[model samples]
Target: MTTLKTESPFIALSGVSKTYRTGNESLPIFTNLDMTIQGGDFVAVMGPSGSGKSTLLNLLAGIDHADTGDIQIAGQRLDHMGEAARAAWRAHHLGIVFQFYNLLPMLTAAENVELPLLLKPIPASVRRERVAKVLDLVGLGGRGKQNPTRMSGGQQQRVSIARAIVADPSLLLCDEPTGDLDRKSADDVLAMLGYLNRELGKTIVMVTHDPEAANAANRTLHLDKGVFVENEQVAA
Candidate 1:
């Protein structure tokens, strides 16, 4: 088992809280959320329905605002960053994978994977080379020309991972990445995620409901109404 490190945290969340207001009622999702993820660590968060898994991911990614708290990732504070700054920060420092494999249907797999790099000021030739390299790294070298819809679930997810890592971001956030796949496809995606964590040394924070998927992480934390009820290290 990999033991918890005493080093400085790569991702830190202190006193984070979130709530949603319906038309008539205010509902609290999670409160006083404190977490610290070390560099090169893979952590999984599991929770039942309505337990704020997606919300937490959004908060960590700087896509959503927390009611109260601080989020410091890769040494940058996200809780107070403006929208444009947060977008820029995310582009340079974070990689995110979604459950739906959010590839543009109109674009080919290579095109979809190349989207992130396009934001940078790199030359066209360099962009092309990087797109080719990342596609091949995710085992989609020849399949880059294929439409993502034509690929299997596992292959599409692989393309997503390729897209996420092309920038070499320090933090990788995955939200229910296996939610749309079958058992075999999910297993393949999980294996690819594991490879990213172990081989590429990405500090990953994944939100999953599947116990098997959670087991792939170095540690698993269980979230309930407002806090973590369990934090257990998984056997490597």
Candidate 2:
């Protein structure tokens, strides 16, 4: 396994541009955008609807491509890698949580949390231990036997988070993770994210429109028409 250099920035985007075309029309979302996220940094991106916040997240996560420029994560150039290579790279290095829980309905909480580890060759006993540890980290240890339908939205989201972190990915990407929850549930999810960043030294990049959600991050960057307009650092 290749280990990421701790001194290097976890993610870097330089002169990146993304463009899309429709019938007789061309649209460029971001042109020559430059961004860098250091290791252990919890960064928030905020933008209006259709401002390309989600697109930016997708690009970072290897789910989408940019038309031009460079993208490097953990010292690997993602733009030069093929689809299968990128997918494999992401499996080993990136953890993502989306707006929807995206949990497997038929699986129990423990099973859902263990989904990522299934890709690895670790022993069954080791996998079970990792699952238990991560579920407990997310405060869902007791609910491991429950199915998604039996759990609250918050609990389900915690299970989703446990699934993401169980593999010990180098970076975490969250796209409106709290968008589907109530205020209290949203707070719980956000607090868990903060705890992961602080306690586990996980690097996180989150896209959200909620001001309070942005406030939870160590630093917030505003996106306008796909470009970074403002960056504010919060006091710890």
Candidate 3:
């Protein structure tokens, strides 16, 4: 995880560009986009469909390659790293939350949380400890033995979050994390995110369509045609 306390930008992107080639046409998403995100800052991205908001998140998370420019996070240059190195970096430094929760149907909440640690060389005892700690963090300590399929949508999402943070990643990338929930459940998840940001010093970048979700963050940026059109701060 990140032990970065120095005040340099936690994430930086400069001259970034990405394009996709389809059957006959080439789609240009964005070009020469620059962004800086600091540690512990909760930032949200909002845009119309097909505006490349999720694509931008994919680029930042290193899940997709940018056609041009550079991306650096926590002083590490991501664009220049090899695939294996990037995977290792991502595994250790980032936690990603998805709208669907993505919890395995067959696994218990604790087992799902323990899955990420299986990639590491840690002892079983340590892995269990980490899983328990994160489960507690996500307010799912008692649901460790519960199957996600048997839990409510909100409970399942919390389990998903526990899995993400079980590795104690420094940065969290959420894509429509509250999109699949009802208003009450969405509020619960958003409040959990806010607590994580304010208490753990985790830097977060989220892509969301809900204005209420965006409002939960410290700042919101609107994207269009791959460019940020508005950047505003909201009091949390």
What would you estimate as the lDDT of candidate 2?
Answer: 0.89
RMSD of each: 3.0, 1.9, 1.4
Give candidate 3's error at residue 101 in angstroms.
Answer: 0.9
Error at 99, model 3, angstroms: 0.4
The 10-residue segment of model 2 with minimum total lDDT is: 1-10
Against the reference, the lDDT scores of all candidates come to: 0.87, 0.89, 0.88
As for candidate 3, its clashing pairs are: none
With candidate 1 superimposed using the best TM-score fit, by how many Å does residue 153's alpha carbon deviate from the native? 1.1
Error of 2 at 88 (Å): 0.9
Distance from true location, Cα of 214 in model 3, Å:
0.9
TM-score of each: 0.94, 0.95, 0.96
Spell out the clash pairs found in candidate 2.
none
lDDT of 1 by residue, 1-236 (tens): 12223368988899998899999899998788898889888999998988888888999999999999889887789998999999999898788988999999999998999899988999988888888988887778888899999998889998999999888788899999998899998988888888888887888899999999998899898888768887566656
User: Whole-model lDDT, candidate 3?
Assistant: 0.88
Candidate 3 RMSD to the real structure: 1.4
